[model samples]
Target: MLYIFQDETTSTVAPARLYKALTIDGDTIIPKVIPGFRTVEIVEGNGGPGTIKKLTFEEGQHIYVTYALHIYNL
Candidate 1:
């Protein structure tokens, strides 16, 4: 069985800053802040929409992430 999880939160940070941190700098930031995360590698694409990244943990567990971006005009 496959499960999908989604979450939403409000932040005081600007959207552009948040986006850069999560997408551009995440590989460096995630391992430092998140325990058990060994490294994050881009397995495919150029870190854009549809890009796939692999997160390897200290215990040899791996998680694959595919990015999808949604833009809304306000």
Candidate 2:
């Protein structure tokens, strides 16, 4: 469960790698960082925009997964 609602911004040790955080392959960091999630795998689409990602977690019983589509600027 999420705790208090607070605003925060953190500086990263790797600035160049930070940009990849929003990219397709960069998304693996989410499930790796976030709790409850066992593994974050790419389900469909290529790599950039419209890529659908499947997230498996312990909280949701692993039966159903949330889908996220990559949105690219260019």
Tens-digit lDDT track of model 1 for 13-67: 9999998998799999999999988888887878776666777777655554444
lDDT of candidate 2 over 21-65, digit per residue (tens): 746445577767777777767788776566667777776574647
lDDT, candidate 1, at 45 = 76
Kindly report which residue stretches of model 1 are placed more than 4 angstroms away from their true locations once superposed. Answer: 1-3, 59-74
What are the lDDT scores of the predictions, listed in order?
0.75, 0.64
| Model 2 ranges with Cα > 4 A deviation | 1-15, 22-27, 70-74
Model 1 lDDT, residue 36, Cα: 85
TM-scores of all predicted structures: 0.66, 0.56
Where does candidate 2 have its weakest 10-residue lDDT segment?
1-10
